[model samples]
Target: MLFLKNPQEAHLQCLTFKKEGKSIGFVPTMGALHEGHLSLVRRAKEENDVVVCSIFVNPTQFNDPTDLAKYPRTLEADRRLLESVGCDLLFAPQEQEMYPAPPVLRFSFGHLEQVMEGAHRPGHFNGVALVVSKLFHIVQPNKAYFGQKDYQQYLIIRQLVADLSFPVEVVPCPIVREADGLAMSSRNRRLTPAQRREAVILHQTLQEAKQRLLNGVSVEEVKKWVASVFAPLQKKDIRLEYFEVADGYTLSAVKDIHRHKEVVLCIAAYVGEVRLIDNVLLFS
Candidate 1:
């Protein structure tokens, strides 16, 4: 329920809580509260004594200026929702407070940052890593929660933590989806009713791909099947960014699906102008 708008104040609060022996759990998010975000908050509430949810729409992550401008900001509603989920603190740092100067340092993830969301949105993960690094420092929580809906983002953060030696644990939670299977996202707000209906295809394609694999289809066959499923969507004004089957752990493209190696079927597409991503795993 307590809100801190400055990093220094939030850092002091976290320090005070640490002195008082309260364990902190943090959920970092951009606002426009949704059920998916609330799900993360609920998990934080269960495991840590004090839960801190941050609502700063990181400016650096957006590839398009208009997309950044269009991103919904409903802090008041988000605050009420966080409180309802029993979150103890809300760190709503202003742009100036968080980024006094333009970020100079960057994070490079080698091959991991060269495809999928990275290929489409250049420097996006660097922005993500920088802001996340800043928040991790500011909150200094015992644990931080992130949704697997952003699987690569979760992976990159895990790598960032290991590389920088952030003391907090980065916990990856499952992707929260809607009744019709569309993955819940903060950007879902931008979808028109017609576009929302079309958005279901992303999940549907992934499901079909998964079922095909379950039916003993070869990896090459499944890749072709997924690509074919997406072709129609792309023609229908749903821009297909990338669709591939890849190693689950490394996120590397799987040329020939290995039996013992776990792989994921991932896709990113634009329904209307709003880009959506969804993925599923294929395990032998």
Candidate 2:
């Protein structure tokens, strides 16, 4: 697999592939390969003639300085994983290469940024929009792949494509989970063995919440039930940041699950300083 660090060089390479009538599939990631990430790459390989994966832990996306510092970087292992999945090219750019100077542009997704991650992580989606727009320009792929674990992000990028008139298809893949049902994450590496065991509670709580919502429970009651599950985890160093059940499309907090065609349960919490987010979609 060819690795290109320069954006111009990567653009030129993709241009050549475009001239050859090859459809490019791009998977953008922060380096630290995991099963969830690989699932995107594998799907890209199946659907497109060329698969391009970029590994750049974007500094701009982190709202907290310490979170950026603690974010994992396993480039060598990431490269091996990409190769194992038959990735055609890897555009692993440095910070300077991606942002030669500070970015001046900011993006707003209206209400999409008002709740969940956006409300909690100020300037988080703006940074996400900045880096993703830059990467979309650099790669110029026919289609881009993102996982549903970050369902809000998937929605933001979809809006980004439509608003900016980018001719790229945004594909959302299903979430990949561990055998124990914990959603796979690069940050899973940061969890201690004990924290790791407790992490399963995040998914378990979501599953139980899902059943309760289906069994004619009120949205508010369901949310309170979720809080009850996490309330005891405080002693174990697991703090719930937010647990929400909102419309899957508008992301507005749903008063009743039956009112919306689709609803999603999204949660963000810290399992001993390792912030983890997971969501489950329920269709009516």
Candidate 3:
């Protein structure tokens, strides 16, 4: 349960572990730990000799300044959760440690970065790519674990690793949900009791959409039906950003959902001021 804050310390520790021929697994996260995050850690522990978890709420990844400010930070609790999950090391670096000055290099993934979450958040995936690339470099593990909840992020990270030859395996774990079916998220803490209740609709909408698609509904009709389910909430205080059906790997709008190898129903909207995202994968 060693906590290493500086790059020099972590780098030395990782080098020593590598010298001993221990396989390293990395789980990068922004704190306020939840069960979903622990799932990744557990997977890493099972498959690798050393599990390294990073807790840095990267400032570069936020499109909304206020949203960044509101993001949760529960470091002490996160440490305890990581220890409970049998994490070998935790790298909780400060902003200055990561970047003493603003970053100059930017990664552009073309169409992959322009659709879905990228289109909605604008510069969001770039920020994600940058921070993830940085963390991947810092950890330099044999394998890195990520949750399937952020399917697009997983895809982009895979692409990043492939394109850059990062020399690490990217493993995606399944999404962990609440008893009521709401996808687990650190942002779930921000939801009011009432908002939390309505948040369940996000998963319900995804489920109904999945059922519709399975019943042989067209892509257009599937989109319309899913939209109709959320019609009631659209007029409410909640800000409905986008409800879309996109190619799971390509992240483009599905013209013929029936022909697609795989499709993911992705949604992003504000339940009050807490912006939440959830997706379900449909295989053809």
Candidate 4:
């Protein structure tokens, strides 16, 4: 596997691959290499001739400085994992290489930015847009893979590709989870042993909510039940930040749950100092 830290060099190498008629598959990640990340690489390897995995912890995306500062960086282990997954290239750029100057431009995603993650993390999607746009340009891959764990993020990148008319396909993979159903996340590393056990409630609550909605419960009542489930966990330091049942496409809150054919139940909470997010899609 070729390990590249320079963006210019990575760009040139990808260009050479293009000239040679190779189809490149790209997976952009903030490193802390877990099975969930490797799952994306495995899918990419199956679909493309060459797979390029990037492990840059983008600073622009974090609204909270402490969160960025505490973000994990495990490059050596990440490289080993990439090599195991048959990744062809690794573009791990320094902040200076990625951003010689602060990004002055901003991205607007209409109402897509007004709820859930965007509502909580101001300018988060703008940073996501800028960095993803940069990576898409640098790799110029025929296909890019992202996990559906961040469903909103997947949708935003889809919009980014369509709006910008990039000649690349955005593929969304399934959310990988632990054996006990906790969604796999890099932040899972920060959870204390007890917090890790308690974290399962996030997924369980979503599952219960899904079943409740299926049983003719009101959207408001399902949302309230989600809060009630988390209420007991507050003593355990698992606090619910927000929960919503919304249209999957527009992401607008669904007042009448029966109106939408498909909606996603999304949640975010503080499990100790580590904030985690998870969701389940409900379809009628």
Candidate 5:
């Protein structure tokens, strides 16, 4: 696998693929690679002639300075993971290379930006949009892969592509989970031994909530039950951030689960200091 750290060098390498009529599949990520990340790269290998994976933990996306400071970076390990999955190119650029100056433009998706992850993490999507747009430009791939763990962010990037006409297909892969059902995240590594055991609750809560919603429980009542499940975890410093059953496309909280053609259960919580999010889609 060819590893290029400079944006111009990556662009030039990818340009050669374009001129040769090769299809490029891109996976943009904030390093600390895991099975979930490699899963995306493996799928990309099947569908496109070349796969480009980027590792840049974007700074602007973090509302909490502590979270940004604590984020993990393991380049050597990430490289081996990518190579094993047959990734063609790795665009691991420095912040200075990607952003010489702070970004001034802000992207707003109106209702999409105002709820769920956006409501909790202010200015998060804007930073996501910035880095994604930058990578989309640098790689110039025919298709881009993103995991469904961040379903809202996937929707936002689809919107970004539509609004900006980025000329790349935004494809969402499934949420890869651990053996215990906890959604796989880079943050999962930060969980202490005890916190790791406690982290399973987020997935358990999501599972119970999904079944209840489908079994004729009212939205309000289902939310109450979910809260009650997490209520006991507060003592352990594991706090539930927000849980909502919403329209998959519009992302507005659904009053009646059956009313929407596509419904999704999304949740976020903190197991100690690590913030984790997960979602399960329900079709009506």
Candidate 6:
């Protein structure tokens, strides 16, 4: 696999592919590579002639400075994993290259940005949009792959593409999870052994919520059950940030389960200091 740190150089390399009438598949990630990330690369390789993967832990995306400092960075191991997955080019750029100065322009999703992760982490998706827009421009791939583990983020990026008219196809891949049903995440590296055991409960709660919602339980009752599931873990520092059941597309909160055709169960919580998120489509 070829690696280039400069965005200009990477764009030039991708341009060569375009000149040769080749298709490009892009996977943008903040590194600490795991099977979940490699899963996206493998799919990209299968679909496009040249696959470009980028590893830049964008500073703008993190609302907490400590959280930013704690994020794992294992570029060497990440590179080896990318190469093993048959990635054609790796565009790992420094923050300065991606953001020579503080970004002035902002992306506003309005109602789309007003719920869940957006409500918790202010200015988070704007930063996400900035980085994704930059990488989309720098790589200019035919298609870009994103995991559904970040279901809300997936929606925001799709809006970014449609609103701004980025000439790239946005592809949504399924959330790759552990055998125990814990969704794979870069933040999973920070979980203590005990916290790791506790983290699986997020998925478990979502599974239970889905069944309850399907079984004619009221929306309020399901929410109550989910809250009770985590009430006993207070001493463990496992706190539920938010539990939302909403339309799968618009993300509007579902007041009545019977009224919605397609809805999802989204949950966020802290397994100790590590914040984790997971979701399931209650019905489609």
lDDT agreement of model 6 with the native: 0.93
lDDT tens digits, residue span 256-282, model 5: 987888999999998888899999997
Over 4 Å off, model 6: none
- The candidate that achieves the highest lDDT relative to the unseen native structure: 2
The better candidate by TM-score, 2 or 3, is 2
Q: Give lDDT tens digits, candidate 3, residues 191-221.
A: 9998999898888888888888888888789
Candidate 2: stretches off by over 4 Å: none
Instruction: Report the candidate with higher lDDT, 2 versus 3.
Output: 2
Candidate 1 backbone overlaps, count: 0
Query: Looking at candidate 6, what is the lDDT of residue 94?
Result: 94
RMSD of each: 1.4, 0.8, 1.2, 1.0, 0.9, 0.9
RMSD of 2: 0.8
Q: lDDT tens string, model 2, 1-284?
A: 99999999999999999999999999999989898899999999999999999999998889899999999999999999999999999999999998999998988899999999999999999999999999999889999999999999999999999999999999999999999999999999999999999999889988889999899999889988988888888999999999999999999989988889899999999999999999999862
Output the TM-score of candidate 2.
0.99
lDDT preference between candidates 1 and 2, better one: 2
Tens digits of per-residue lDDT for model 4 on 151-263? 88988899989999999999989899999999999999999898899889889988999999889999888888887888988888889999999898889899787788779
Off by over 4 Å in 5: none
Clashing pairs in 1: none
lDDT of 3 at 34: 95
Model 4 C-alpha lDDT versus the unseen true structure:
0.93
Provide backbone clash counts, one per model. Answer: 0, 0, 0, 0, 0, 0
- What's the TM-score of every candidate structure? 0.96, 0.99, 0.97, 0.98, 0.98, 0.98
Candidate 4 global TM-score: 0.98
